[model samples]
Structure formats: structure tokens, C-alpha cells
Target: MYRSNVLVCGGTGCTSSNSELIIQRLKEEIAAKGLEQEVNVIRTGCFGLCALGPIMIVYPEGAFYSMVKPDDVPEIVEEHLLKGRIVKRLLYQETVVENSNSVKSLNHTPFYEKQHRVALRNCGVINPEDIDEYIAVDGYQALGKVLTEMTPQDVIDVITKSGLRGRGGAGFPTGRKWLFAAQNQADQKYVCCNADEGDPGAFMDRSILEGDPHAVLEAMAIAGYAIGASQGYIYVRAEYPIAVKRLQIAIDQAREYGLLGKHIFDTDFNFDIELRLGAGAFVCGEETALMTSIEGKRGEPRPRPPFPALKGLFGKPTILNNVETYANVAQIILKGADWFASMGTEKSKGTKVFALGGKIKHTGLVEVPMGTTLREIVEEIGGGVPDGHTFKAAQTGGPSGGCIPASQMDVPIDYDNLIAIGSMMGSGGLIVMDDTTCMVDIAKFFLEFTVDESCGKCTPCRVGTRRLLEILNKITSGNGTLEDIDRLEELCNYLKENSLCALGQTAPNPVLSTLHYFRDEYIAHVTEKRCPAGACKALTNYYILEDKCKGCTLCARNCPVGAISGTVKKPHVIDTSKCIKCGACMEKCKFNAIVKR
Candidate 1:
């Protein structure tokens, strides 16, 4: 056995930052130094503290290395691997706590301190491709327990007591959804996992599948046994190639171990799973549309009253939950219900994972308790807004959710609290914004995404969202009138009232929320024909600050249009008539002289 193992992050975030090359170089360096027998190299999934990647942790000492580069390999090898000395320089800044001698492990970091990872339990801890490693963690033990010790009704009771709900936008009770399928007297029953994570900056579900594929399989089998279904399907987008490949490997591994297929765990529980690839339609995130596509039909949403729990997947009794939701199942069964319920807020009992993104300093995956204040997430954990900019507002739940303005920063975040303020806990996409962000433009961007993603199932969503986009575009372009703003508001309500599905109905949220929170910016856009943030090109003009202008010809030379005129060592005047407001002068100016107003 090797004396020491160097584990490098293999998640997409760290991989992009050159963690793969570090692994290769570490192996080479160790081999070159003849320490292969003494030193081991490994590549693992995200360690949660994603900003510190490319991360390398040396075992035995558990020396946590942050921002490691390829060139730093030899020193690490010679010093740490060869001489058994800890490389202090490569260690994370937060390695030591403020008032403690114990080095802060990834678990103790403030970024992970509040997070109780039930669903994400195995992620970053184990290599997903290794089946033996999964087994070591009692991977299929939950499935075995369910099949051998529990009845169909018992499975439902455990889950119901666990207080688990769908993590895929709609927070329907998971146990209740499964019960509907079990109670329906049908010759054929089905189970589906909605792996079609279509939210624009959301990757929580994908990361779980990529890091812990076995968890989902175990949970699905448990679901199958509960619902009396022999056949199960995982409807995942084709975009997630890595997750897909690992899932396929996991399925093969499960079958080989008799955890799936006929008489699972040697009980008369027969169940199997199939993978259905989607052609990348955002609207297919809806359960009905996903099931329809699974049946080799056109992908579009169908109206629900007979929700997927009762009538889904070819009019059979079906149960559907997203990847993250299923990821929580086996753990809940294994850990007990009160253990799961004890973590989160009163209304929302369980930890929530967020794809922490946008203007924040720490951009990565963060799972926190339900009632954690936005201030704690943005300020302390997120390292505050980058460059000391003041926080403005945050957009949660992707295009279907609304913006939470600065005034509401102290509100405890949970499903009900967010929705109370006109936002919903949609698959957990939290995008932080700062002073520079234009709420009008931000809303317009989400509206634009919804317009393209609408399934055209109904006129209100298809035509109505497009019209809303047009009004937002007109306002940003300095062409919208007061009447246009009124018309936009009317359409937002109409779409909310008449759309056939959630995707269509909530499409106008960004438009409505931005108008509510940042009406001053909207009025500036419409009344004065000016974009306060200078994000709207038509409403902005670029000016060269006379005091700071170096007049190096950088600005004038880089101007796409020859609108900037000046000589060396002199301030330039922008010919507004010829200016396209492209901000080329601002970008090329080294002296910080360009200003937009």
C-alpha cells in the first residue's frame, strides 16, 4: 500500500482550472522520483470549496493544497512526497480557524459549515466510477433493507415521515406522489427520474449524478419496490455526457451485483432501469413533456390535474422526481426521518443546494440550511461581492422565479419564504448581483430565455412572452413609451393567468419582479431614455474623463467607428453623432478615463 495519496479534484470546475494536468504531473513526478510505491495519485469529484481548485489534498497529513499549478508539482513531490514535509505555501488560506489549532477540513470551512449534505452525502468523498467504493459506504444497503425487511406501504411510511419533497421546482411531497402511483390499480406502473436540469446556471443535480451515481440507482430501486413498478426510466438531457457515462457504468455495476433486474436482493422484487436521452428542450423539464418524449413522441407539455403521480408515462400509474430529490431517498431511509427533519427551517425541513453564481467572489456549489439569511451567504460565506461592490439584488429559481431586492436581504431563505416574496425555490439557482447590475436588463435577459424555451403549447405563453420580450427590448433600446410599460404589465398578468403549464405561467416573473423592485431604473429607461447602469446601449453614451485621459490613442484607435478624435497628450472628444455606444474606447483606455452615462 502507498504511504501517501494525493487526491486532485476531477469535477468540471477544477478540471477547467487544470486539475487533470496536476494529477498527470504528480504521477509523473512521483514516478520520476522513484516514489510510486510510496506515493499514490487520485482524481476525485468536487470538494465543495470549489474556489480553491485546482485542489490537491495529501493524505496521512491531510495537507490541503489550494490553487495548485503544474509547475508547483516538482516542489510538492520533492518536499512533501520525498522528505515528508508539509508544503505550507500550497495550503488553503482558511486552513486554520480563527481560534482553533485543528486545521479546518473542507467540512469545517464556513462555506460548508451550515450545510447538512443528506442528498449530496457521497459527493466529493468517493470516486463515482468505483463500484467497490460505493459498496463500502453501504451503497445498496438501503435497497437491501427495503426489499428484505419492508413492504411497499412501509417504504411509503418512511419517506412520508422523512418530509421529503420534489427538489425540481415544484415542491410536491415525494411520498404522497409515490402513494398515488401505488394506490392506482393498473396492470403496468412506471417510475421516472427527471434528470433534465434545464435551469440556466444550475448544476446541482448534474454534480450529484456525476459524483454519486449509485445513490440515485439505489433510490430508484427503492421507489420501484414502493410503487410496484418493474420498469424505470431516467430522462436526462444529452448535454450531460459525463453524468450519462457514469450513470451507465453504475447501472451495469448494479445489475452485475443483483441490485437491479429480476428478484433484486433475492426477494421477489423485480425492477430495472433505462436511460432516455432528451434532445435538449428546456420545456421538457416539465414532467408531462419529459414522459411524452420518453415514449418516442414529440416533446411538449400536457395540462395537469391528473398529475404525473396518477397519470404519467403512457397513461399508466407513474411517479416522477428530479435527480436531486431521488438522491435524498436512500439516505433518508437509512438515516431515519427525524434526522432529516431536524436540519432545515420549520416550513422547509432539509438542506438546500444552490449553484452559487453571478457577481459573488466564491462561485460554486453551496448547500446551506433552509433558513440561512441571504446576508450570511453573500457576505460571510460567499466572501462578499467581488471588489467591495455593494449588494443590489439576487435572482433565485432561474427564469421562472423573481428577484429578491436588497431590502429583503435579511429574510430567511426557504421554499415558502421565497415564494412569500414572489420568488420560489426552483431547482436552486441563486445569482447574486451588485450595484453595477441593471434590474431591467436582468429581467429582460430571463424573459428572453423563457421566450425561446416556451413549448408553444398555448397562445398566452408563446405569443405573450414574445410580446413581453419586445416591450423589454424596446425599453432598453430607448424606444418604449409609458403606454408600452403599462401594456407589458398587462401581458405579464395575462400569461400568468392563462398559460397551460408552469413553464409558460411563470415565464413573466423576471419581468414582474424587476418592475416591482427597480421601477426607478425602468422609469429612467422609459421617461428619460437613459440606462442608469449603462447596460442598455441605446440609452447610454460613452464619455472620456478629461482629468484621467492619457490620450495614448488607445481609445481612438480601438474605436470601431472613428468617433473619438484627439491628439497625443490631449483629451479626446467623442463625436456622439458618429458614436455607436460600443464601449470600445472604455475598454481600450488604460487610464480609467472612459465613463458611460
Candidate 2:
């Protein structure tokens, strides 16, 4: 056995940060010290704490190293691996207790202590590219049990009893969806996994596919058995290159191991899975649009009553679930419904994984029980908003969801609770905002994303969202009237009512929620022609505070538009007419003299 094992994060976040260089340096160092036989380096997926990556964890000691660089590898190998001395400086601060030489367990850290890892069980634990590592973690055992022991009805019944709702926005009952497809009399039903996570800050789906591709594969095969499906398709976005590459690897491995293709577990049930790469269309996240895209057409939503379960994917009965949803399926089947049902709230069973981003301190991925409060996630788990900035609002569910204001910070995060507060649990993306954020600008930002991503297939999403974007632009640019606010509300409701798909129906959520909670900011923009948060450039004017200015010409020198004029030892003055509101003068002022309002 190897005396020491070194695990390096190979996820997209760490890879972008040159974690690959760290890995290469580690191998070279280990070999140079002639400890290659005693040491092993393994590349794994994300560790959830994206802020501190590229991360390295030395096993046996479990020394969690953050921001590991290529230069640090020699010292780590020579001292830690060769001499067996811990590099206290490079260790994550949370792992080191106050005045204690010994390290704390990585799990006991605040970021991870409150989290419950179900879907992400194998992530950051096993090598995703290796089939043996996944199998050793009991990966395909769920499919084996289902294929050998349980009937199709038995599989469906267990899932139904588990009270597990879909994690992909709508919170529909997964078992009920499966049952509908199972009940339909079709010779060739289909199972699909939606890995097209288009939310701005969401990476939950991509992480799962990259770290635990075999888990999704196993769940898909189980879904096939339960729904009488002979084939399955995973609709993933092309932008997720790591996830796609790893998923394809897992598929090849599963087929080679007889876990996927042609009579899995040596049974008569014949099933297989294929991949369909999408061109990163946000509308394809909706079921009908995803299915249509898989059928070699433009990724656009079709009118419903004929949901994917009844009529989908080439007009046949099909069941589709997203990556996070599928990641939970095998666990629910293996551990029993009661085990899965015991953790969460009454209606929402099982844990939910969220990609926490924006102004939060510890921005990364997190999974908490369904009823966990936003306070716990944002403050305790997320390390709260950074730099003493007060929390303003959190945007959940991307453009398809709404913002949760500070007043609702204590609210429990679940499908029903989120919907009650003018937001939906849209694929578990939670972006925290600071007090500096402009609510009106936030609304406009999401509206712009929706306007760009709308497939133009339906009139409500195509034409209506564009009109809403125009009004928001007019308001931010200091050209809007009070009547424009009323017009926005009216159009929002109209689109919600008349939209053909969920994308259009929920596109106005950000605008509606901001208006409901932060109406003062909007009113200020319209009446005073001033942005309350000073985020809208047209409504903002930057000025130098005479008292705070140190008579330094730094602001004047750095001003790109030559808007600032001052002597070397005197206070600076800004020419507001010439100022582009670019804040270059403010950024150069060391005395904190420049201010915008």
C-alpha cells in the first residue's frame, strides 16, 4: 500500500486556476525524492469550496491545503511526504484550531458542517475517470438490486413513498412522473437526464456529471428498467466540456462492465444510453424544449397539456429528470424511502444542492436539507456577505426566479416556501447580494439575460421580454416616468399569464420581486433621476469629497476622460459633465475622496 496519497482538485474551477500544474509538480517532486513508490497523486472533481481552490488534500493526515500552487509542491513533498511534517502555513485556516498544533477534521469546518451530501457523496472522494474507484464506492449496486430483485411497480412505489420531489425548478414528484410514463402504453418509452444547467451561477449539475458520472448513468439505467425504456439520452450543454468528457468516459466504462448495454447484470432487460450535446440554450432547460432539441430541431418549447411524460421526444412517452434529480435516485432506491424521507421537511424530502455565488464570502457549491433556512446557508455556511457589507437580497433560480429580500433571510428554502415568496426553487442557484447592489439594476441584469436567451419560438417570451427589457433600460438611463413602473407591472403579469412555457411565464419574476420589495429604489430612479445604489451609470454622478481629499493629484492623473482637475497638494474637483461615471477617479483615490450618487 502507498504510504501517502495526495488528491488534487481537477474540477473546472481549479483547472482554470492551474491545479493541473500543481499535480504535475507534485508528481515530479515525489519522483525526485525517490518516494514515488510510497506516494500517489489522484485527480478528483470539485471540493465545493471553490473560493479556496486549487485545493489539495493529503490523506491519512487529511491536511486540507487551499490555494495550492506549483511552487509549493516541492516543500509539501519534501517536508510533508518525506519528513512527515505538516505545512501549517498552506493549510486552510479553518482546519487549524486556535493555539492548537493538531488540525480539525475538514468536515467540522463551518462551510461543510451544516451540509448534507447525498447527490455529491462521491464527488471529491473518488477519481471520476477510473471505473474501479466508482465501483468500489458501491456505484452500480443500486441498478443491480433493482434489476435482480425488484419489479417495475416496486421501484416506482419506493420512490413515491420517499416523498422526493424534483430538484429541477418545479418540484414535481419524481415517482409520479415516472409512473405516468410507465402507465402509458408505449412500446419504446425513453428516459432522459437534463444536464443543461444554464443558470448564471449554477454548477450543481456540471459538478455531479464531472465527479460522479457513473451515478447518473446508473440512475438512468434504473429509470429505464422502471419505465420500460430501451434507451436513454442525456441532454447536456456543450459549454460543460469537463462534464461531457467525463460523462462519455463513464458511459464507455459502464458498457464495458456490462452495467449499461444489452442485458445488464446478465438479465434479459436490454437498455442503453446516448448523449445529445446542446448549444447552451437557456430555454432548453425546460422539458419540451430539451426534448425537441434532442430530436435534431431548434431548442424551443412547445405548448403543454402534452408534458414530456405523456408525449415527448418524437411524440413518445418519455421521462426526463435533471442531473441533480438523477443523482438522488439511486441513493433513494438503495437506502429505502424512509431513510430518504426522514431528513427533509414534510412535503419536500431529501437534500437540495445549490451553487452559492455573488457577493457571499465563501462562494461555492452547497447541499442542505430542504427546510434549512437562508440565514444558515448565507451566514453560517456561506461565511455571510464579505467586507462588512450588509446583506441586501439573494437571487434564487436565476432569471426564472425572484430575489429574496433581507427581511426574508430566516425563511426556510424549499420549493413551496420559495414559491410563496415570489420565487421558485429553480434548479438550486442561490446568488447572494450585498447592500451595494442596486435592486433595479439587478432586475435589469436578469431581464437582459432572459432577453438574450429567449428562443423566439413563442410570442410572450420573444416579444414581451424584449419590451420589458426596453422599459428597464429606459428607467436605468434616467428617462423613465412613474407611469413606466405601472406599465412594467402590467406587462409582467400579462407575460406570466399568456406565456406558452415556463421560461416566459417566470421571466418577469426578478422584476416583480424587486418592485414588490425595493419599490423605493425604482421610485427614486423615476422621480429624482438618481439611482439609489448608484449602479445605473446614467443616474449617477461622481464627486470628490473636499475634506477627504489629501491634495493628491492621483485621481486627476488616472481619470481616463480628464474629468478631474487638481494641484499636487490640493483637493481635486470632478467635471461631472465630462465624467463618464467610469469610477476610474474613485478607484485611484487612496484617501477615499471620490464618491458617487
Candidate 3:
């Protein structure tokens, strides 16, 4: 055994940030110091604290190193590994206790304190590529237990008791879905895991797959057993190349170990899984669309009622659940339903994993109890709005969800509570926005995404969303009237009532929610002809604050359009007509003279 094991993040976030180079450098440094045998460097998955990547953790001591660079690796290896001294400088600030030498555990950090990581339990703790490592952490044990001991009905009962709802936006009861498929008598049945995470700022599913691929595979196997299905498919987006590679590796490893294929655990039940790559279509995230895509047809949602449980995946019975939903299955089996049920609120049991992003200090993955308040997530866990900016609103559920204004920050974040407050707990993308964000522009941004992603299967989603975009555009461009606002509301209701799929039905959420909460901003854009937050480019103008101008001619020199005209040592005047509002002058200015209004 090695004296020290250095764990470096190998997830997509860190990989993009050159964590691989840090691993290479760590190895080179250890070898150069003649301590290769003593020090072991292992590339693992996302630690959830993505903002501090490329992250490195020294085991035995468990010193969490954040934002590590290649150059810093040598000193870390030399001091931490060889000399047995912790690198205090590179340590995550949260890990280092203030006014004391003793550091708190990673779980005790503010970012992770409120979290109860059921799905993400093995994520940062294990190497996803190695089957033995997964087994060491009791990964496939749940599947083993289900196959050997529990009956299909018993398994379904456990899931039902757990109160685990689908994490894929709809909040459908997972056990009820499984029971429906189980009760259906079909010659062929299938289990599908929707890894086609298409939310704007969501990466919860991607992170889970990358960090703990075995969990999903094992869960799929269990799901297959529970629903009497022999074949399974994981419909993942092609964009998640890292998650795909790791999942394939995990599958191969499981098969080699006699965990998959015929006679698994020497039982009569035979279950197998396949990978179906999606073309990165946002609409394909819908269950019907995902199954339709798997069948080599155009990705589009079919009419529901004869849901996937009765007829799906080639007109056979199928059960579909997203990556995050499946990630919880194995743990629930091993730990018991009550263990999972005890954490969350009465209605929405079990923890919820959110891809905490946008304007937040800790922009990463967070899994907290269902009843955890929004204020706790935003202020404590997310480290509040970044740069001392006050929290204004948080956009949850991407295009299909609504914004939670500061007034409702204390609302308990559960499915019913979120829906009651005019927002649904969609795929758990919580994008924190500061006071600087314009609510109208934020709504328009989501509308733009939904409009572009509409499958056009029906006129309501295709043509209707386009009209909504037109109104948003008109308002943002300073040409909107009060009548246009009424037209927007009317069009939104039409899309919600008549759209072909959930994609269109919920497409108006962002627009509708913003209107409900921040209607004043909309009125300002139409009546006052101003973007209240100064975000809309057409309604905003950059002005040179005379008192702050140093008369250095910096603004004039940097102006790409030559909009500013002034002599050196005199205040510059900007020709508003010529100005493009590029903010180049503000960036180049030594004195804070240029201000957007």
C-alpha cells in the first residue's frame, strides 16, 4: 500500500480546467523526488465544489486543495506527501478552521453543511472507472440484495414507502411508475435512464454519472429486476463525453465481474443495459422524445395517457427515470426506505440535488433535504450572491420553471411548495441571480431557449412560442406598448393549454413567473422605455461621469466606433448615436468615469 494517495478531480469541469496536467505534474514531481512508490496519484470524479477546480485532496490527512495549478503540484508533493506537512496555502478556505490549526471535515464546510448526499454519496469518494473501488464502497450490494432476497413486489413496496419522486421535473412518484410497469403483462419490457440533461444551468445528472457511474448501472439493474425487464437503455446526451466514457468503463467492469449479462449472481433473472446517444436536443429530455430517439426516429414527444409504463420503447412496456432519480435507487435498497424517507418534507421525501450556478459564490452541485429553505441554499450554502451583491431572485428549473424572488427566499424547497409558489422543482437547476440582473431579460433569455428548442410537432409550441419571443424581443428593443403585455399573457396561456408536450406546455413558466413577480419591470420597459436594471442594451446608454473622469483620453482612444471626442486633460463627450454600448471604455478606463444608465 502507498503511504499517501493524492486524489485529483477528473470530472468534465476539472478536466476542462486542466486537472489532467495537475495529475501529470503531481506524478512527475513525486518521481523526481524519488517518492513514487510512497505517493499514489489517482484521478477521480467531480467533488461537487466545481468553482474551486482543479481540486486536489490529500488522503490520510484529507486536506482539500482548491483551484490547484500545475506549478503548485511540486510543492504539494514535496511538502504534503514527502515531508508529511500539509500545504496550508493551497487548502480550501472552508477546510481551514479560523483561529485554529485543526481543520474541519469537508462535510462540515458551509458549502456542504446543509447537504445530505444520498445520490452523491460515493461521487467524490470513489474512482468511477474501477469496479473494485465501487464494490469497496458497497456499490453493487443493493442490486445483489434485490436479486437474491427481495421479490419484485417487495422491491416496489420499498420504493413506494421511500416516497422518492422523479427528479426529472414532473415529480411523478417513482414507485407508482415502477408498479405500473410491473403490473403490465408484456412479452417484452424495458427500463430506460434519461441521462439527456438539457437544462440551461443544470449538470446534476452529468456530475452523478461522472462521479458514480456504477450507482446508475446498479440502479438500472435493480429497476430492471423490479419491473420484470431484461433490457435497459441509458439515453444520454452526446455532449457528456466524459460521463459516457466512464459509464462504458463501469459497464465493462461489471460484466467482466459477472454482475451483468446472463445468470447474474448465478440467478435466472438476466438483465442487460445499452447506451443510446442523443444528438443534444433539449426536447429529447422528455420521456417520450427520449424513447422515440432511442428507436432511431425523429426526437419528439408522443401523446401521453398510454404512458411509457403501458406502451413505450417500440410499443412495449417501459419505465423511464432520469439519472438523478436512478442514482438514489441502490442506496434506498441498502439503507432502507425509512432512512431515505426521514430526510425530506412530508409530501416530498428524500433529498434533492441541485446544480447550483449563476452569480453564486459556490457555483457547483449541491444535494440538500427537500424541505431546505431557499435562503439557506442561497445565503449559507451558495455563500450568498457573489461580490457582496444582494440576492434578488433565483431561477429554478431552467426554461420550464420560474424565478423565486427575494420575498419568497424562505419558502421550503419541495415539489408542492415550489409548485404552490408558481415554480416547479424542475430537474433541480438553481441559478442564483443578484440585484444586477433584470427580471424581464432573465425571462426573455429562458423564452429564447424554449423557442429555439421547440420540436414544432404542434402549432401551439412552434408558432406560439415564436410569438412569445416576438413580444419579449419587442419589449427589450424599446418598441413595446401596454397592449403587447396583455398579448404576451394571452399567448402564454394558449401555449400552456394547447402544446403537444411538456416542453411547450411549460415553456411559458419563465415568462408567466416573471410577470407575476416583477411586472413593474415589464411596465418600465413598455411605459418608461427603460430597463430598470439597465440590462436591456436598446434602452441603456453609457454616460461619462464628469466628476470621475481623469481626462486621460482613455475612453476616446478605446472607443471602437470613435464615439467619444475630447482633448487630453478634459472631460470626454460621447456621441450617443455613434455609441454601440460595448462597455469597452469602462473596461479601459483608469478612472471610473463611464457608467451605463
Candidate 4:
């Protein structure tokens, strides 16, 4: 019964920015003012606007504060908490009404306006560590409903009707996977969750586990019942300390409440879950590899003829879904399948959560209905490319996905649509690029990651990706021929066709997509030995503009190799032989006289 509730973000993004200290300071300030009973401070999950973290929100008034520092606590406490005055200067600019003292709801802001949170519904709204807070929001009601009323087949049918697809890269049908597992009769069946989110610039799954661990736990229980499994395991990477800690807490709390262990709701059904920490192997994100890692073996992908649903997790029938996919199950069960189906496109039904990042103004977690245009996400929601930079291209699906040129920005974002445009909805990582970004370099970067992360279980991913890297290196180093470009395409096709697993099969996506869309950049790199975006050092040179340079001798002084030779008030010239291409001279030049060519 507090008059004011201060919700401080405790998610990883905010925690890194010192939100924990903000919470502690808020409590101390509240106690010193003797408003402890009247004021309540709670630590919650990510609010999705990660750019403006360590975010703080004061409820009853809903004053949204961004990038809060420890020193600012007193003013917030005295002026806003004690005196009831809004902290105008500290508030998120988007929430502040222009020319008026009034503020708008956070939902109405451009960053959040287009977002329709389904998997992220409970995130940031409740304290994930407290089971009571979770229960207050109809947390385990879906498990209760499924356990008490619906048949196992009925549960499968409802999920099948919902059109929910796996959020872990492949976009496979959730219901179909469940049905396959349910049909298989085994003495032991296993349910596994893939929290080993390895995609670059992606944190959607991690945020869900941090913000709403119960949603995933409850969903796993329902899945266990539906698939006739008593034991469940979550394969999470050791990197996500917060998610892992909160998940363990949620599991303990649920078992203590008789919601997880033994006969739940006094029914004959019995189920439980456990955690298996991974050593951060990127390939282990694959279903078979994840399960294999759980079995205490080196994480590597197993060929799929009998997929996880048919034979998995120690040679037993198993169903494995990622954290985000499980996060949606309970909702689909409670809200009904049609309710979920009504939102997304016909083929790609339900909402999709994306870890929106890179070059975008608003870099954070965003959940939107399937088929939402990339333009809507980039221009309207993400606030477009920052610093007056023109939009160039967007990379989705991490190392496994392709680049979508600006020409295809309007294409509806869905499983089929993205696949149609040479990209796939792989785990929902949307990285926006600006005009300055080199598409060829972008492809090379992703390819390098793939080459480093390859499990070495197969030659295509292990050796082929290495050969591809060499070719890209040659091109970027300003020594490549037209034949080399053709060779790259040939090798890419071979890897896609002959690879042992999805890891190898999709490894060429970045290279192939860039070659298809930004072929001019590739040709320029080979033909003219020039990186059009001036990204590759070997292909670019820095020069001081004669008209712009005041010959302040700044460039010469800043050059580490003394490459720039010039006097005060005279045009500077760079000695290309001595230049390291470090761009130090360009960075120090205040005249904006330096240009890369």
C-alpha cells in the first residue's frame, strides 16, 4: 500500500550502467526521509530502451528517467518523491510533451509505439525473483489450466492452432514439434530449453530470462505435461549471469509453492526442471548440440534424421525450444490459439521479438507483430540511422542470415518473406547499417565469426569457411581478381549444399547476400582495389583537403609515423609509404579536412 513505487531496471544493460547502485541509493534516500512505508522501490527487468539505461520509472505519476546516475538520487527523492514534483530535466525526452510541462505515456513514444509485446509482456512489469509478483500477473495460470482441464492432445492442438514458430533461428512450427514428441511413447521423454543465445548483437532470449524467468519455467512445465515428460533441463550459456541466477531463483520458488515439483495441483502428473551451464560454445545453440552439451559431452551438432523430438537427450524422445519460444507458450495456452493467430501474417503467425541493434538510434529489445515492415522498425521505431547518416543495409539472423539492402526495407518481416529476400528470421537479431558501413566488410566480419566458431565437426564449416575467409582477406587487402569473386560464389554454394549441419549449410548467407545486393562494392574492391566505404585499410588512403586544411600542423603532429609533412598555414601532404592507415590524423583534424579514398 505504497503511494509511490519506483521501478529501477535491473536487467543486464542497466546493471552494467549501475542501476543496482541507483536502487540502493533510492532505498537509502527513502529511509532517510522516513517515507519507507509510503514509498516502495522495486528492481525489475529491461524496459527495452537500452540506449537510455540505467532507466528509472516512478509509478502513479509514471515519470520515466533515463541514464540515471547515483548522484542524481537526492534530487529525485526530495523533489519528486517527497514533494510530488516531476523531474523534467531527467525525464526521457520522447515522453516529455513539447512546449508543455505535461508528459506522455512511455507506450506512446516512437520507440515503443509500434511494439506489441507478447513474449515480453511480463518483462519490466514485475520483479522476476519474486514468485508472488509473478503469480499476481496470472503467471502459472496456463500450467494450472493445462494440468487441471485440457488433455495433452488438446494442449498440442491449441499451440498448433496458434501458428507459433520456434524463435530459435529455424522458424519451425511449435505445435508440430510438440505433436511429434507426444506421439512417441517412451519410458523417458525430455523437455529442453535453448537459452544459449549466440547470435551477434542479439539479447532477446537473455532479456526474457532476466525479466520473466517464470514465464519460461511455467511454459516448460506445460510443455512437459503436453509431451509427457517429468524432467526438463535449460541449457543456458554461462555468460548470462543475471538470467541464470534469476532462473534458479524462479525454479526454487516454484517448487516451494508446489507449482513445479511432484503432483502439481494434486494431479497424477509430475514434472521438474534443472539448469545446465554451457561454456559459451556458439555451435551449441543448435538443438542437437545443446542437448549433447547437457549430456556432459563436447558441444557439437548431430545429423538430423531422427530430430530431437523423435530421438534426443540421451537417446530419448525430446522436444527442444529456445527461451523466447517457450516464453510464448503459456500466453498461447491462456489467451487461446486464435488470439495468438489473429496478430501475425497467415504463414508467420504471432508476434516476434527482435534484439534491435547496430547503427540505429534506439538500440534495444523490440517485439512487433510478424510481417511488420523493416522500414517501420528502422525508420519509425528505431529512429533510423543516427547522426544524419543515410540508411545503407540491415543484417539479420547473425552469421547465419543475409543482408537486406535498402531496396528491400519495405518487405514485410516474416519467416517466408525474409527467406524470399535471401535472409531468414534467424533468432530475430536485426542489426541496422548506415551509409558509412562497408557491405563487403560486413560479410567478411560475419564470415570470420563463423570460421572462428565452427565446431570443426565437418569440413564445409571448418575448412571451407576458412578458404572463404582467405578470399575475403585477399579482396579486402587490395589483391583480388574477378576470378576470385567467382571462386567465392562457387565455394559458398558448395558449403550450402554439402555442409553437415545448419551451421555449415547457412554459413555462406552473409557472403552470398552481399555479393547479390552489393556486388558493386565487391567489384570495386577487386577491379579498382578500392573499398568504396573507405573501411579496408589496404584499399583506402587518407588525404588532407587543400581547401579545408588550414595547415594547423595538427595532422602532422598526430600522425604516429610522421606520414603527414606540412607547416603551419600550409596544405599537408601524406607520405603513403610511411602511413599506417590508423586514421589518427583524420580523427585529430578539427578542420574536417581529411578524407579517406
Candidate 1 C-alpha lDDT tens digits along 448-473: 89988888879998899989989999
**Which pairs, if any, clash in model 2?**
551-570
Q: Candidate 2 — which residues are off by over 4 angstroms? A: 98-101
Which parts of model 3 have CA positions greater than 4 angstroms off? 97-102
Tens-place lDDT digits, model 4, residues 379-443: 99999998999999999999999999999999999999999999999998999999889998999
As a whole number from 0 to 100, the lDDT of residue 25 in candidate 1 is 91
Instruction: Name the TM-score of candidate 3.
Output: 0.98
Tens-digit per-residue lDDT, 1-597, candidate 2: 998889999999999999999999999988899988999899998999999999999989899999988999999998899998889899999998666556889889999999999999998989999999998988889999999999999999999999988888999999999999999988789999999999999999999988889999999999999999999999999999999999999999989999888878989998899999999999999999999999999888888887777899889999999999899989988899999999889888989999999999898999999999999999999999999899999999998999999999898888889989998899989999998899999999999999999888788889999999999999999999999999999999999999888889999999999999999999999999999888889999998888899987888888888988888788878988998888888887888888888
Off by over 4 Å in 4: 98-101
Q: Quote the lDDT for 550 in model 3.
A: 77
Model 2 score (lDDT)? 0.92
Model 1 steric clash pairs: none
What would the TM-score be for candidate 1 when compared with the true structure?
0.96
lDDT: which is higher, 1 or 2? 2
Indicate the worst ten consecutive residues by lDDT in candidate 4: 94-103
Report the C-alpha lDDT of model 3 over 296-370, residue by residue, as the tens digit.
999999998899999999999999999989999998999999999998999999999999999988989899999
Clashes per model (N, Cα, C within 3 A)? 0, 1, 0, 0
Global lDDT of each candidate: 0.86, 0.92, 0.91, 0.93
